[model samples]
Target: MPRKRPGRVRTKNTNRREALKLSTMAPEDYNVRPGEVKSIACPNCRTWRRIMGETVLKIREHCISDKVADGEKHVTCPGSNQVVIIDIDVSHWQARQNRLLRDAMPQENRRAARQFYKPLPAPAAPVARIHAGVTLETARRAYLAHVEECVRCGTGQHCTRGGALAHRYVLVRKEELARRKAHKQSAPAARKALWDQRGGATVETANNQCRPRLDGAVSEYRGPQVPSKPLRVIA
Candidate 1:
């Protein structure tokens, strides 16, 4: 077999040396200065770029599969094709560092990265039970009425108390009104039925009275009446 190329052997030696150097390096050896935007080469595309502070820290804290926790300046390229864990303290000087890094980046890239991390507003307190015995229906109606009234007055939008009161009133009144109306309607129908039955019975009794007396009408009529007028001869 032909002798192994000297160049290939040398390249292999160089790679092995570099790997040894990296393995021997401690986490503290890569301390990043505050306000410095460290550029890292992408392992996949070999492109160089910088990352955000929050992203860098988060990755540094949780990216490693090994059990050893190395608090360092960790960063991954935007494409996530490469990750670097460096020993650095950039947390306290993040703002200044990010500003410089942002300035170095293209205007479009900088704008894309610029975002506000606004916290979401807290939820509102639940509506309190202002009035007892208020049914849901009544409460809902009251709430609607209050809204309507507010719209008319132009001051209702700001009236928290008014809305609550309205809801309560609607709930109670609606139930009561419904009950009263139902009673009124049903009561009349019942009374009318009773009156009709009574009238029917009275009419039946009157008809019975006109019939031949029960005690005297045992036999059929068998009588001839005397002539009131002389008979006319019309042969």
Candidate 2:
């Protein structure tokens, strides 16, 4: 007969009774660390015990039911180490772990932390050219600035581009003057229309009636005089 090779002996029996209990088990009851041994609330002992090995599948093989001291007799847990089939939500577990890790970080550390980012390419230099359909105000400002800077841009005379820009500026000023004149002419009629809409005549009559009554009250009423009795102090 060949000599029996020495090896680690298995402890704790994964009997049928313990395996049946896992059917009603929830994910919360088990503490899972990815790439590490998983621990669960022992159904038999009602204490946290580690499931055997890094691989969670094939869990029916064995489990560490309870912690044993040197020379102490191992108490076998009623929970089954055998009778396989365990479901693990890997994504949910990873998300939960990440949340916990974030929460554990210090406020200062977390605040300083930045996501990985590639620096944006620098913006291209703006094109140097006159803008199309420039507004009157913009043209006026540019014309004034150009005349102040350039010696050639005098009262009537201007550079080639300046001549075209100056014409646009003059046109804008003329249009603005026309608009202001039209608005001034229409303003009194607009105000009268708004006043009529609000029944201004009735409001004015109410105000006139209130003013006379208020004047009469003001004329009759004298402000309160100082109290006559001044020597009344209780002991």
Candidate 3:
């Protein structure tokens, strides 16, 4: 009626139908609102979109209540249909801003607050002590200096090399002495009979057989030597 202008013009009825179609579409089909969150469990994608209309309304309300700057954007929840208008205190917000500004600067340029940083103290020194008297040191040295020498070599080094030979000779001599003593203690008739059977070869062979066998069982199980009593000092 007012003068139809523009190409592909729609009649009044057609324009009304188009508007109705748009209105019938769900609010979610368009945009999201601040504070109002919507959750969808769709097979294709699971995501929430804010409704701009609702967001703008809630933001306006929050700005009035909190007296926040008009330039700040409102925050939105991404879960179910719920909205929350945040009204942060100006002073608290400023402190938070200051912290962020400080954090943005280089570490070397930042001021060190002693309240946040403390130096560790140095460790204490250790105690010392001294010992007196002749002690064990003096005693040990005197003992070594006056120790007995080897009888065979007449040297300070004890004779360990000729030990086996000396042991065998002592054993043989002891056995001979025992046999002679037994013969002397025997009755007159028994002694005469033993003397009648004695031979040089038999006596020598018997003495050799009586000596300990180096490879025998008794030698293998020999116990450690028992130490003799310490010699008394003449002084």
Candidate 4:
């Protein structure tokens, strides 16, 4: 209950009212204002108890449970009559608490509470399609399967869903054909370039081998061969 104010020295615990020792607590521990019923959860017992005074707040003395006359030894709670001093400004603490509560709310729920918009049901999809990297054969099979199952599709026509599937299949087929054709046309040139590179490498290697050991350069990736004769050790 003791607070920092100019000129008035903080009274010692011995001099405090009700003979209860002073215990400093954070403003968040209890709810209080100029004209509201102040209450706090007892720290030791974890039970909600009304704060005891208007000018100075203190934790009320409380027993654990049954009274002495009940013949049950419930015992008194250790938190009895403990003085609580709220040092922080109540108004400032209240403002910060309000801001925190607002921030904690969900983004959707933070809007006006009076809003009564009904949530729209999610739109369902028809048969899911492989939008990317779909092979031509898979597309063709899917189109054929859809057409077979759909009664609206006939020998020379298709229903809307069947028609859409067929169109996708056609596009995939065209792309696959174009890719294969390009690969076929480029195969000869690719092979020729590969052959030319290999031929040049072969000729250069042959020339290097034919030039003999004039420069003492060892073959790549192969160390020099061991000498056939072991020398006699001179003692």
Candidate 5:
């Protein structure tokens, strides 16, 4: 596409109230970097306005108050249509701006532009927590239920969550089997202990039921009785 035609340059006859030198103004307020359209902030209104015309750039005419259209008094900005002379070195101004920007940036972000960036590793899949009372039946039901609801699992495959549930089910099943095996192994010892306790009670009951048949001495082995007072030694 053809480039835009350069507008008229500043002629000696182009009357203006005052002229603004680019060097005298703040570097930030005016931009005249090479290859970019020139723009500057209006001194009175402080709004950025495009520089019209080639060779001799003029700030686009604008009002002092933007609210002038809304039944407000119209006052033209003093900087409007003001002639801007490019007196400063554009390259030097750009370099200083670059330095200032680099200094203002956060310390962590300053990096070599050409360096290879290692792509971040993909995020890990989320899984449900196994609470205190998770059991084999409950785990299996959960896995099956997830498989039924998930669209991805309908094709005889597991999604991330479904896979996690299936894994939990298998783990719970293994744990339950191991627990059952342990309980089976311990049953004989528990039974023997219970039998011993019952046997002792039965023997005590039988002894209580039977009274001594011998007369006169009543030769039952009773424990000695406590004395009423302490024995006194003869002095």
Candidate 6:
């Protein structure tokens, strides 16, 4: 029989401890210092073994799951071998820190530091409300929408605002109709004028010639006019 082999060792779970540490960590603790190499807790492993280099001063190298001397198995951190970009502008960060520091200081100290900027004063009187720009179609649609709801509303018949809106909508519709009618009438006249300019017979001359012919044919159709009422009544 073959000799029995040792089973693979399992890694310890330090998630709870890492969670506690994360809960207590301050905002400033995450800020990486310029020109300094530091070790931080690995995001995947939750262990303080991830090294941040000073050359780029950002996380470029991933965590390696190395075994401890006790022959225990280390958990395979998923973030291993993944390239991480930790680009932080030091000058902008320092400027933000300085601004925060200034804001936290007393007014007297701030006055000694530099001249403070003041915001513009608000206007004295409240500005009147201005109507938003809208097209004629949009205006007509809005008035119609109000009119539709106003009929079913509890206000019943005394809805003056709805009435006014409806009146305005009707006037708009009338104007639109007038515009369409004028366009229709002008189109034929325009075509006739263009045809006459191109040496064709004018529409007016054609109508004048046709009028007498039509009247004569109508007169020739009937023998004579017969009186509907009594001749005695006429006498």
Please name the candidate that would achieve the greatest lDDT relative to the true structure: 5
- Tally clashing residue pairs in candidate 1: 8
**Superposition error at 83 for model 3 (Å):** 99
How would the candidate models be sorted by lDDT, starting from the highest? Answer: 5, 4, 2, 6, 1, 3
C-alpha-based local distance difference test score of model 4: 0.69
CA lDDT, candidate 2, residue 118? 85
Model 4: ten consecutive residues of lowest lDDT: 6-15
Cα-based RMSD of the predictions, in order? 23.7, 16.0, 29.7, 13.3, 15.2, 22.9
Q: Where's the lowest-lDDT run of ten residues in candidate 5? A: 215-224
Supply the TM-score for candidate 1.
0.21
Q: Give a tens-digit lDDT track for model 1, residues 1-235.
A: 5532211111111111111121233423333454454444333334443432332221111222222356554442233422344443456445555666778888766554468889999886545345666676767666666667675435645376565566566667877899989999999899879878879678768878756555643334543354447989999
Give residue 161's error in model 1 in angstroms.
3.5
**Stretches > 4 Å off in candidate 2:** 1-137, 148-156, 210-235
Considering summed lDDT, which 10 consecutive residues are worst modelled in model 3?
56-65
Q: Give me the displacement of residue 62 in model 6, in angstroms.
A: 80
Which is the better candidate, 1 or 5, if ranked by TM-score? 5
Q: What local lDDT does model 3 show for residue 206?
A: 78
Q: List the residue pairs that clash in candidate 2.
A: 14-81, 18-80, 60-81, 60-82
If both were scored by TM-score, which would come out higher, candidate 4 or candidate 6? 4
Ranking of all candidate structures by their TM-score, best first: 5, 4, 2, 6, 1, 3
What C-alpha lDDT values do all the predictions have?
0.48, 0.60, 0.38, 0.69, 0.78, 0.51
Candidate 5 at 215: error in angstroms? 99
Model 2 worst lDDT window (10 residues): 53-62
**TM per model?**
0.21, 0.32, 0.16, 0.40, 0.43, 0.25
Off by over 4 Å in 3: 1-152, 156-158, 187-235
Tens digit of lDDT per residue, candidate 3, span 107-137? 8888766546567886753211111232344
**Candidate 5 at residue 2, lDDT?**
61
Where model 4 places Cα greater than 4 Å from the true spot, the runs are 1-129, 200-235
Q: 28-102, model 4: which lDDT tens digit per residue?
A: 567765555667777777787776654555666667774667787867677766666666677887897778789
